[model samples]
Target: MYAYYGKEKIRMQPLHLLMERGHSCKLADIVKKCLRLDLLEKVTMKKNSALMMVVLLLMAVVLTGCASDDNQAATRTITDMAGNTVEIPASPQKIATMTGPSYEMVFMLGGKDKIGLVRSDHATGYPLALLTNSDLPNYPTIKGVGPQTPVNAEQFLDAGVDLVLYYNNAAELEKFKMAGIPAVVVNTTTTVPTTTEEYFEQSSANLKLLSEILGGEAVERYEKWYAYLTKNVELIAERTKDIKEEDRPVVYWGNTWGTNILSSYSRGTRDFEMELCGGTLVAPQEGGQFPEINKEQLLEWNPDIIFVDNHGNAPELVIEDMYSNKNWESLSAVQNKQLYRIPSGVFFMDKGSTNTLVLLWTAKVLHPDLFADIDMIKELQYYYSTFYDYDLSEEEAQKILEGWVDAENLVR
Candidate 1:
């Protein structure tokens, strides 16, 4: 005999085992035998012993059905950026972002409550996190997990992580697979885009992939963000397309890491942003993405405008040093007071979602007369309110544009 527990089949044993070998017996015979032995009356004198047996059997079947349901966890399959097919939880409760920027991306996608771990370097100090979430300081962080560092799967497992977001790291992906953890690569492109079309395509792909993973409101937000990005990119491109080559200013975008001020992005999105905003990149494309040029080379280039990337050091301090340094005295940017600091929020304006804002800001800076109607403060406020769901006052928006950090909320 068999009993069906939902979709599962449970084999039922014969009741004749309760009787002598080779003897036939019905359910009533077993109940009668139990009642006669006083087994059924031990707890209470039940007039319906057969009914009690039927009730107990029904409870057992229900419990077995529940047990079967517990064994089947809900999941969904997705192909990551690196072409790896991964099965992840339908709604991950504990998400660990191995990449620093991805932490902000996930937070922006309305998955802040699902975030269980974040990169330690970008955990507490980000202006976006401070402005948006008051509880950001208490979020858990893991150190030494990024593109250069090897992934430690055990640490993530110990933290009860249900999903992991990472960049292109095959070894790390394999490690997560071996540990039975679902990892998704979120990189937009494997290589730097050489053209404007390629850049937008890659950027769009990145946002779409993230939205697909974190569905619901994330998909709606992605559409809004991409539309805004497209609008600004087209606006800038249209305005700058007709500008004469001789009229374009030679611009230099440098990063400030420790005492090094000449470390600049030679190509990729930064270069495209500069060119699209009526500025010619002073650094050659062949020099690689992040190359450190010497003082002599910088003097030779003598860019008209200098934009300092506030990476490891404060932008104001780096600009102040450049103004005081004897070697930079002859540079046209310093002499003309054209040195400007790139804006930062959740992430640096040069990268991530803020890149759109940077494009608009850069166009206004390079060609003030042409883009006189562009109000960056209002734009900043709108972006924060629309995407981050946080209202920013004029003062707070100005502070972010000036690259100001809240020291009280900042962790290192």
Candidate 2:
């Protein structure tokens, strides 16, 4: 703080004061009573609107004195993914997030210090919390919690969380709103990112928007993630550009463990992944986003390649079902052993900043020549270490490539 006594402006440490009732007054009146008339008379002033406005506002503030930083909090408004207009702290010190893809994004963008707590849904643990050096599990937990879960207002307040990053928790979000606690919906990843292009666009948009709330180091992390995504996407595109749809291999993918209830990506993000990887997704023509086709339909399609989502909590069971089922033996993908699984980690490689890695992995499996020289494990090491600050062991990288997780070692 600076004050004018007579001629020179002297710097003064601000003394915190409680705002008195009716302390605020009109601008002209404040300038008349508060400011040193001699200082104003001697000082040269700017005539611009911006400078004049600042001068007036500062003058008013000067007269009113000041309050603690907490009493004069800085904030801004943003429309969240759920279309809720929320005002959040300009620089949030403590944050709470639902653990999964959203929490993973928060950890990558901003480190774990600001993250004071986590809300768990299924599996009762956060992927990063279980796997990383951040000791995520040590943070207090609102365990087995979600939208329908009871809103524990006292728990949040006690944890000192001023900002919250949520996904699929409408009930809790409403509670926070009513309590005047600022919570922003961050759907960093879900089943939404289906195609490579959509993946980049959605992930970039998420990072850019979230960084504005997290601020500081988050922006730098986003730049790194975006640049890496662009380079990988372009490399894949350039190599597979000339391939035609009919020439591509037939592909099928399932998020779950069993093949009994067969599912595949339609004309959505998953379909684009097939195209991006130089393959064609084969599924029922008319059912829905995730059309469940039967054995007869699977026999008809006889997909040349199959990709399983290993991050969906049951990869081992899913892979076992695929290999042991007699009905699957007749398929081209199974006979040729072209079956591959999606990478798993803090967030599935299919979404968030890891989406480009999915494209790279899928392309490598579908068209080996395109990514012949690529070291997928090496890439994973760099990405994980740089973004999350978590070291990726070569052994673990191999498992990620194979879409396998030693669940007992990582998750409780």
Candidate 3:
């Protein structure tokens, strides 16, 4: 018999040849020969079983390949602002922040629950922990955080913190990295912002970075806040931009605690606010360094309008000084009763809480005829509810315009 072997024909003896003529034949030839029906069925069944096993194994391999992506994304790596590469979970479950400004970012992002330690001993938590949010006042304050202070590694470990946020704290960031934890830097200005525009830029950057990490209502809230600021600021800018340089009001900003000069944000962000509101800074053309000027210098610059920061009740004495002092009586601001105190709520509005409110306030005060339609209280109500997630009643907003004292009882 001729059997096809690949493309060639080979002569082979049938299995029956051994039975019929007792001829020698190889096992291959025997298997190919028509011997018995039952034997043939058994051989075919064995080959089919082996083929089925191979098909099953291939299917499993393909399924595993499909699920590989999900398995790999269990963790991720990111580079922080300080250029430190860090490995973090795909979603952070535990978090800690070192500085107050960073904490402020976290708190606004609704990541307060993710925090490991409650806070560092120093708790400014700017624009974040408002007096309205009752929980912030009572959050546990971690002590011993300052210049030359080492991070408490055990706190992170014990609290199961997976991520830490610092403001340019390289040493502490390294400590977290060495301890098998990831720390990211959120750059905030320790120095004053030279201009209001720069201040907004930095603030928006911080907010956006935090939103990307937290991944929730943060982005929406931040966008709304940003839009709100831009709309009002642009309107103010348009009104003020074309004003003649000579016509711009000369303004002075004082940061005095009682009669004492604690510090001043001259030519700083707040000073820029005066300019954008159609006024000239008494001390302009400076950087983020809040330069100190004496009473004599202030007299030399006899500003048309004066704004005293409400920091440590400076407004109380500043207002009194303007009202009673003989030296101040010579100034136009004091004589015309333009000596006003900057407003505050959770924190000072002019300080850091929300400058949009103050910007609007300043613009209206500087050019009342141009900004007649603006309602400061309504804006504050929107800002508090929209940005901070706290409700600001009409009364509360009005109180915020005056000073922080009236808004002390506000709650989230």
TM-score of each: 0.79, 0.74, 0.67
Question: Would you list the clashing residue pairs of candidate 2?
Answer: 194-269, 195-269
Which tens-of-lDDT digit does each residue in 289-342 have in candidate 2?
Answer: 456767787788788887777544566676677688897789888788877777
lDDT of 3 by residue, 1-412 (tens): 3334345544433333222221122232343342356544433333565534533543443334435434545456676665667666666756676653466556656666666555532243322244556666555456666434788766666556667777576777777766556677765444455665775775466667767777777667667778877887888989998999888888887776556532566464555667789998777445443556767877888889887776545476768867798877888888898877787745556533376778888888888898999888888877777667788777777667766543222211
Looking at candidate 2, what is the lDDT of residue 17? Answer: 14
Instruction: Assess the local accuracy of residue 226 in candidate 2 as a C-alpha lDDT between 0 and 100.
Output: 85
Off by over 4 Å in 3: 1-89, 97-100, 116-131, 143-161, 169-181, 187-200, 256-259, 266-272, 284-290, 312-314, 325-327, 351-353, 405-412
Give Cα distance to truth, residue 238, candidate 1, Å: 1.7
Better of 1 and 3 by lDDT: 1
2 versus 3: better lDDT goes to: 2
What lDDT tens digits, residue by residue, belong to model 1 across residues 23-103? 122333444454464554443322356546654664444334444333553467899888889887766777887764677
Please state the error at residue 310 of candidate 1 in Å.
1.4
> Which ten-residue region of model 1 has the weakest summed lDDT?
16-25
lDDT of 3: 0.63
